[model samples]
Target: MNSFFARRYVITGIFITLAFVLLARLFYIQIIDDRYMLFAKNNVVRTQIQYPARGVILDRNGKLLVDNQPVYDVMVTPKAVKPFDTVEFCKLLDIDKPTFDKYFDKAEKYSPSQRSIFQGQLDSTINAKLGERIAEFPGFELVLRSVRSYPDSIAGQFLGYIGQANDATIAKSNGYYHPGDYVGISGVEKSYETELRGQRGVQNILVDSRGREKGRFANGMYDTAAVAGERLKSSLDSRIQKLGEQLMRNKVGSIVAIEPSTGEILCFVSSPTYNPNLMVGREHGNNYMDLLRSPNNPLLVRPIQARYPPGSSFKPLSALIALQEGVITPQTTYNCPGYYVAGNRRVPCFHNERHGTVNLASAVAESCNGYFDMVFERLINRTGPKNTDTSFTSWRTNVAKFGLGAKLDLDLPGETGGLLPKASLYDKWYGRGGWRSSTVISLGIGQGELEATPLQLANIEATIANHGFFYKPHLIKAIGEKQVVKAEFTQKNYVGIEPQYFEPVIDGMQAVVDRGTAVGSRIPGIVMCGKTGTAQIRHQDNSVFVAFAPRDNPKIAIAVVVEGGGQGARWAAPIASFIVEKYLRDSITRRPSGIEPGYFMNASVLPQPAKPKPAPVKAKPDSTAKPAQAALTAGKHKKKKQPVVYAAAILKGDDDE
Candidate 1:
């Protein structure tokens, strides 16, 4: 009996211990560990992301260049979807049956419980219509989003476009972006993406099983408000930008204009350009494909991407370097017999005039290849009998000070530093000691291996305008209202050459517009210092011109390049002059042949449709004709032949040297 009682006591102890352990676990789950409670709450609570409106981009004058337009996206949760009128839904969305099927399949593949975009970028009108009847649709919901809209469809490449972010972008966004988020693809939009894409907020709300919000989860206590992106005031002048585009409408080239004192970009134009609006909305993919296939490559940002020899335009920099090195002076003279002869190779000057004895200023005005060639040889061979690598390196360094052979680090992307051949390149081409100044005399005239982008060329002109110092070239003038530009842009960048060396070179450039090759392009009442370059290429010579206007206290500096456009004076020079006139004088005074000044002044981003041919003077119908009969006769008349849409003409030839 005693043994039985002990066993009963042991059994009772075990029961009590199990009971305590169960109670402890229950207490830990209900109070100590809140994870399970939160998990239960998550089933009833829904979190929604609030996307902020992107910033507005404006020209310097506060003209709206890019703004946000309210667009709606039809979102779907596949699991919540129920069978409904497929035909009616397709009709409302204005999509075909096949398109609806495609979107539905894509969303189902993405997720069954999570929301995904079904139809995105619907205009306000369609969105309003859809919202009125949205209650009938079970699984779909309307989500508000903003898409870019342009007031003026100019500066396509400069302004860029926004597109839906890909998986890679989302992965790198650190949880900031989702698959459907829009991001800038290129241009200023891409360069300033961080500043332009504002902070996103979130709202947690109580929801029923049907996914309809009941109310804020915690009376809005956990909700975060979205912040709008900062506004960007660009340095672009819309008027000048329009003019540049008009001038380059039918050509393949680029134009870059800047304010020399501030490094503010006035206008950036790439030829064969399309309207920025073409890349907006749902049709972007199709339009982008068309642009990609274009033979003229309208999408190329030529000002910073395309590189070419500067041709005669490089003479001013060469002269400045020569002066700084004490190899040449304003009075230093060189005799030219039409060409400079070095052993078996002869570099000929375009001008046949003997130019018996030419000084620095005269040589620049005449673009005397022979004179610059001689000066370059003297500068390189100055160190006794051997042309040391150090001399070439120093020469290249001076050239770099002008923003050559290195990227200018402009605010835009895809900039190239341009090609500045090194001594090692020569050593590889010819044995180290075998190559000398005579072997690369072509470089003195801005040919051979020397290459420069249009932006670099323009900055060189601006540097000259600033008298040996320049600010970094930039497109943005200010950020938000109170914020100024970055300190780096404001800081002065000085070339190695001294300020005094610019006077003679400036005088030479003045002569170029006053009476030289580019005399025809000079603006009236403006002291424009300019240089014309005909860069030799595989095709037609690329016409190039670089200039800064009002030689004293210059304001506007510009560079223009027309691929395969023969002489700089004939094409690029005139365009630069027009840009200067429009910027400073606010109107063009001189119009090139066959082009009216008003054509540029009143240019539109979209081509103006040709007016219908005047109706033929048909014999008047009988006065008794009925109104319906007359309308029928008018409609029956064959429509006038539609005017041919003009495309950018592709010119082919070799570059002039």
Candidate 2:
């Protein structure tokens, strides 16, 4: 009897201990561990993401360039969905029943209990029309969002466009972005994405069965407010940008104009551009595909992407380099015998004109081929052929100081460094000991492997205009309402060349617009300085020009390229001149007779359907020609008789090569 009572007592003691441990665990789970509580809360609470408004982009003058318009995304938690009028819902959303079914199935497959986008990017009109009736459909909610809207349909390439986040972008966002979020694809939108895309928030709302919202969950204790993106104040001048687009209409090229003192891009125009608005809204994908498929390659950001041999426009920089190396001086003179002949190779000058005994300034003003060729030869061989690579590297290094052969780190996307041929490139082509200065003599006149984008060329002119120093070329002047200029852009970058060396080059550029090749493009009172170049291509040469205005305390520096536009003086020079006049004076007072509004605006250089050749007529010799025709005929060698306004088969195909 004693043994039985002892066994009973031991069993009772063990049971009490077990009960105490179980009670302790229950208390810990109910009070200390929030994970289970949160999991339970998820059933009664709906967490809605609050997407903030993307920042507005404005011109330097405070004109709105980019704005936002409210849109909605119809979200659904499929498990809570009940039988509703599918036909009525489909009709209200303007979607066919099959399409609605497809979307519903996709969302249901993605998640049954969690919400996912059913239909996205519905405009405010649809939001207003559908919001009132959304209560009829269980598990459906209209979540507010914003889409980019371009007020002025300009700067399509510069402003870039936005699209839904891809897998790569979402992964990069570190869980911040989901499948339905929008992200910048290119241009300023891309470069400033972090600043332009604001902080996303979340709100927990109490919901009953069927996923109908009752009110804020627990008095909105778990809610976080969304922060709007910081505003971007772009350096672009809208009026000038619009004018540049008009001037570049139907042409295949780019124009980049910058303020010399600040390095602010005034106008960035890439021709054959589409309306930025086309990159927004429901038609975005189709419109983007069309632009992508266009033969003109309108999507190309030509200012920073299109690399071309700068041709004669490179003479000024060459002159500066030669002067800096003490191989040439202001008084240095070289006679051009029509061609730069080094053994069997000959680089011909413009029209192969013989410029007799020209100084550094005159050589640049005349775009003298032999003069710069000899200068480059002396520059390369000054240290001797044994050190050819060293000298070439020195030259390359100097060019880089002026923002060549390297990215400018501009406030936009896809800026190519342009090609600055390294000694290794030549060393690979010809055995190290097998070549001398003569082997790469073509680089003297900015041909062969030397390539620069319109932006780099414009920046080179800006560097020269600033007298041997330049601020990094940029598109955004400030950020946010405080208008904070980036410290990187404010720092001055000085080219190794002394300021004194730039004087002769500047004088020659002044003469180029005043009495030299670009004389016809001279602005009357603006004291513009410029250089004209014809970069050789397979089918038709590309016309190129670079310029800066007012000579002293320069405000604007510009570069223009016109593919198949013939001579630089005829097309590119005048285009640059018109842009300068518009920027400085704010009015184009000196429109050339047939070139300004009619020719530049209407002319198309892209290939068109061939028309029957006009029947040849007997040649008549008459001295009389219109000012426009005379301008073409007055040059040393007459241009081929292509129509002034339009031509067929002009693009006969050459890529930027």
lDDT of 1 by residue, 1-657 (tens): 999999999999999999999999999999999999988887898778899999999999999999998888899888888889989988889899999999999889888878888988886677888899987888898988888988889999999999988888889989777767889889998999999998988899898987788999889899999998889999999999988888888777889998999999999999878899988777778999999998778889988989998998999999999998998888999898777765344556663355668899988887888788888888788894375577888888899888999999999888888999998987785567766676667778897788999999999999999988999999999998776689998899999888888998899899888777777776778999988888765324677999998998899999999876667776677778888988998987743223334443343222222355444443232211123222222223222222221211111111123
Instruction: Give, for candidate 2, the lowest lDDT window spanning 10 residues.
Output: 648-657
- TM-score of each candidate structure, all chains considered together: 0.88, 0.91
What's the lDDT for residue 59 in model 1? 98
Instruction: Name the top TM-score candidate.
Output: 2
lDDT of each: 0.81, 0.82
For all candidates, the clash counts are: 10, 0
lDDT of 2 by residue, 1-657 (tens): 999999999999999999999999988999898888988888788788889999999999999999999878899889888899999899888899999989999888877877888888886677788999998998888888898999999999999999888879988879887767888999899999999999998899897764567999979988999999999999999989999999888888999999999999999999878899998876788999999999879999999999988988888999998888898889988877777765344655666677878999988787888888898889889989899899989988887888889998888878788999898877785667556777677678887678999999999999999998899899998999899889999989999888888888999999887778777776777798888888764345788999998899999999999987766776788788888988888887743333454566776666343345434333213212222212222222233444543221111110111
Best by lDDT: 2
* Segments of candidate 2 deviating more than 4 angstroms: 591-595, 607-657
lDDT of 2 at 530: 85
RMSD of each: 14.5, 7.6
